[model samples]
Target chain A: MSTIEIAGKTLELDADGNLANLSDWNEDVARELAKGEGIEELTDRHWQVINYMRKVYQENGDAPSIRKLTKESGVDTKELYSLFPKGPAKKSAKIAGLPKPKGCI
Target chain B: MAEPIEKVSIVISHGSLEGVYPGLIMANGARMEGIEATVFFTFFGLDAIIDKRMDNLGVATVGNPAMRMPGGIKMPTWLGAIPGMSRFATYMMKKEMEKLDIPPVREFIEMIHDAGGEIYACKATVDMFHLSENDFCSSLDEIITVGEFYEKSAGAKIIFT
Candidate 1:
């Protein structure tokens, strides 16, 4: 893990660039985190996936996979990829301050 | 760390659940890692993209070792040869996969395609099986020859499953 300055706060990020401290995340932090992932801006659609990921992680103590996100996360696979270029499951989770997903589909 | 490879071109040569899933899973996994991926269905692999047979494909239970019971007990060869054993094995495997949220064959194809991975059929295999363009699933990107496959797979790692 390492530290990066965002919104005037030094935030610790894990190896995958995910926020190490949950309390360190805010909309500003999320936007900056997303920018590091090559996402220029967090539109409403992007927030949809991020918020869903945070909610699921909060309730289940883990992040949902791509299947769960597509099936119930109010977004389909195509749109999810468009929103977060490559792996939406991991990318969106990082932006949501959740750990990386470990399972393979 | 740097990405090991840029793209993968998977060749699925088997029709059974064990045969086809390796290629599908690999391609889908590649896309998940932000790598380009493509699946080439040839020979018995055609069964995977064939709309009429895709959903009905079964795993091999006969004349095979490593087959097992629910608790991991080894399955006897004789038991595997029973008339309905293959179907039963396929059923059990599907149920297990469902519990893990693995999508069915058709859905998996759609997932890969939508994730920017390409899917295709071998022209020679399609002809050998007396099949036509209309026989494939809607997600199939094209029906090409071995030479065409090689061309499309240029600069990509070739994985035969």
Candidate 2:
């Protein structure tokens, strides 16, 4: 476990770097996290994925997998990868302050 | 930073709905973790890449000893061979997958490709089926020989399903 300080608040992260407490998530925290992920800017497209992930997590009790993220999140698979780079689902879930997706590995 | 399992090569050899999905799901999962993924389709698994048959994959209910009914009772193989049983099983499986937001075969393959995952069909299988490249989905990267697949899979973790 570790802590990342954002906007004067410390938030917990698990060993895999996902937010330990979902309640600590906010736009500011997401922006800071995104920057660390090589995204200097969080465009509307980035927010589209982030918000969609958070919404789905709230409804489903887990982050959407990459398949669902691409098909139902209003972001195509190509765009999602470009926006989040490397691993879209894991990165977006980290930025959205959600747990590591259930079956990401 | 050290490269985390740089690539994963998966082989899908069965055409049944159950047989095909594990490879797809694992490949997709690999991409989600930033690992490069490649899926090699051969034998009956070729159905998963065929343009017309990919989306219509059916469950192999007959002779599957592990299949069970909704209440967890073992599904007798005799019952599985009844007409329309395969279709019913397929529908039930699709519904379960849908409830979990798992995509259909076509969309799943597209998602893997769009995410930079490589998809391949076995050349011999293509020849056996008399399938042209056009018979496969556009996302297929190529139809290559087994030797060629092994060459490309060098240094990667290979999963046979």
Candidate 3:
């Protein structure tokens, strides 16, 4: 594990860069993380995906895969790639402060 | 720093819902990891790309020794051979996948394509099945020979499902 200082708080992150402690997540932390991923601004659309992921994780105990994200997160697949380029599911989960979604190779 | 995996190629050889999903899921997962991913649909796997059949792919319950119920109980092969069992199993699996928000096969393929993953149909399989390029989903990248596929897949991790 490694630590990243976000919003004056040092938080542990797994090797995959996912938050080690889900409780350490906040909007500020998400913004910090998103900045590192090349997203300078967090639009409402971005929040929609992050909030949906966090809600589903809290209920299902794991982050949803890209399939679920695109289908149920009010974000289409094309918009997801544009919102979280390269790897939407993984990147969004990191910004949402959730674990790396299971079933992703 | 070590280089992350660059590419991955998956081969889908079976037609059942159970058979097709592993390849799709793995390819999607690879793309989620920023790895270039490709899926080669061959033989029965062609069912997944066939324009008319892709959306209606069914589970193969008969002769499948690994069939299981929702509670994880093993289903006997003999019982699986009963009429409508395959359709019933497909329905159950589809329901479970829907609950988890997994897209159906056709949409899944489109998602992969839109995500920049490549979809291929085996040329031999297409010829054998009397299917032309028009018979496949529009997302199909190409129908190439096994030799050509191997050439393109060289240096990439290969997975057979």
Clashing pairs in 3: none
> What is each predicted model's overall lDDT from 0 to 1?
0.89, 0.90, 0.89
- Residues A13-89, model 1: lDDT tens digits: 88877788899888999898898999989999999999999998899898887778888899998998889877888
Displacement of residue A88 (Cα, Å) in model 3 is 0.9
Q: What would the TM-score be for candidate 2 when compared with the true structure? A: 0.91
Best by TM-score: 1
lDDT of 1 by residue, B25-125 (tens): 89988888888998999999999999999999998987678789888999998989889989899999999889877899999999999989999999998
Name model 3 segments beyond 4 Å from true: A7-9, A21-26, A40-44, A55-61, A103-105, B1-3, B68-77
Model 1 TM-score (2 dp): 0.96
Query: Which DockQ values do the candidates obtain, in the order shown?
Result: 0.76, 0.61, 0.57
Angstrom error at residue B135, model 3: 1.1
Cα misplacement distance, residue A69 of candidate 2 (Å):
2.2
TM-score of 3: 0.84
Error of 1 at B97 (Å): 0.6
DockQ, 0 to 1 scale, candidate 3: 0.57
